[model samples]
Target: MIFLDGIPISKWGLQIQQEHDHPAVPELRRKAMIIPGMDGEWDFGSESGPKPFNFPLGFIEYDKNEKQRRINEFVAFLLDPYGRPREMKLSFDYEQDKYYRVKIANGFTPRRIHGFAFFDLPLIASKPRKNFMVPSDEIVMESDIPILSDLLWDTGFSDRKITSPQSFEIINNGTVVILFSFQMEGSGDNVSFSANGKTMTFKNFANKSLEITDNYVVKVNGISDLTISNGIFLELLPGTNQITVSGSNLNLTISESLTYQYV
Candidate 1:
C-alpha cells in the first residue's frame, strides 16, 4: 500500500496452490503513482500497519540563463531591506526507494559593499642614505689653506657629510653624459672643493676659465657658449682631457658627492 497526496493505494498480491486439483499463478513488479507535495504514509499489510516514507524533492531541470537570473534576483532581494518576496516553502518528492527535499527561504536585509582601486601608479621611492666625497688630490696646509690635485676623486669617499645632489651618469655608445647640479659662488672663476684630507678650497684657472657676470653663465672647454643658472648642469662628451673650466670669477659649492663605475 502507498499514500500520495493523502490518498491510499495498494499493490496487487498473488497466491498459488499447485497439486492434482490446484491452479498456478504468476507474480509481477509493483507500480505506484507519486503525487507531488504528498506527505509520505503507506501500508503493506495488517502486521506491517501504517509505515512512514520519504519523498524526493529537488530541481531536476532548469534553463541555464533563467536559473542564474532567478538566483541573482533572490540574492539582490536578500541584500535589499525594503524588497518584497512572493513565496518561500519546502518542496519534496520521491524516486525509486529514495526521498529528497529542498528547503528554500529568503528575506530582505540591509547590506553595503565598498572597495578601492588605483590608477597610474608610480615607481616606489627609495630611502635616502649617506653620500661621501673624496678629493682627487692629497691636502697639505699652507697658511691654513688647502689645495687639491688635478685628478678627479671618487665622491663616495665622503659619505654622510652633507645632503647629496641629484645626479645621473649614463653612456650612449661611446659617449658618456654625466648630469649633475652644483651651487656657484659670486666669483665664477673658481669653485669650492671639499674632499678627504683637504679643507674646502677655492680652485682657480688661468687659460680654461668660467666667468659669471650679473647673469648666471657657464663655459665648457674654454668656450663661453653656455649660460647657466644659480646651479650648474654639465653634459660632457667622452675623453679624460676633453673639457676644462677656467676663469678668475668662477666658484662652486658642492653639498654632497656620489660615485659610479662601469664594468
Candidate 2:
C-alpha cells in the first residue's frame, strides 16, 4: 500500500507494481591539489550532502463518471500552495514510516487506459526520506496556569483550552528536529510559543488565538503583558528544550510529537 498525503495510490487510480526506494545523492564533491614538492595530487577531504528520495508513481485506471476520477483532484492536491511543501509520509505497517518534503518534478502525463485515464509521475524530494518511529501522547491541563515542570516527555494538552499564561518542558530524544503544535482559544488575537531559546509568535491580530493552522477564529479573547512583537516558533533539538508560553490570555493546548531516529 502507498499513500501520498493519506490519499492511497490505489484510490488515486495508480497501479502498483512494487514499492521501491531509489538511491539519490543531492551533493557529492572531492578536493585535490598538487604542488612541486607534493605527490601527483594531495588528496583533500571530500564533502557530501544529505541524500534525497524519488518516487515513480504510475496510474492504472481513471474514469470521469464511473470511478471517482483523480485526474483533477490529484493535480489540485499536489500542486496547491500549502500542499506543495508539505511532508508526505509513506508507510508499510506504520512501523517503517518514511517522510519526505517534496515537490512534483516531472512526468505527470495523463494518458488514457482502458478508456480511462493513466499516467506516470516522478517526484524529487529536497532531502532524504526519513524513516522514524514516533510516539505521541496527550494530557489535559487542570488549571488555567498549569505547571508542567514534572513533565519529562512530550505530551499533548487540551485544545480550545485554558486562558492565562502557560509554561512547560520536554526532553526530545530524537537526533533531528521535531515540530510541535499548539491550539488555543484567543481573546486579544495575539499568540505565540517560546522554547529552546527560540520562539515563533504572532502579533498581527491582537484579539485571536494563534490558530494559524486553521486560520479561522469565531471569537476573539486574549490578553497578555508580554509586549507583542514578531513571530517565533519552537524546533526541538536532541536533548532538553525549555519552554515558556505567553500570549493573549489564550486557551492553549499543546501536542508534542516526539521524534526518534533508528540508531
| Number of the top-ranking candidate, with lDDT as the measure | 2
RMSD of each: 38.3, 9.5
lDDT by residue for model 2 (228-254), tens: 445344666667766676766464444
RMSD of 2: 9.5
Q: What is the C-alpha local distance difference test score of each model?
A: 0.26, 0.51
lDDT of 1 by residue, 1-263 (tens): 22222222111111111111101111223444556688763433332111112222112113555444544543443233555422221111121121111112223221212221111101110111111112112212332211322222322221122123222222211122333223232344343332222222234433343433213345444355443323444432333322133334433332222121111
TM-score of each: 0.18, 0.46
- Residue 83, model 2: lDDT of 50
Looking at model 2, report the run of 10 residues with the lowest lDDT sum.
211-220
Worst 10 residues of 1 by lDDT: 121-130
Clash totals for all models, in order? 24, 21
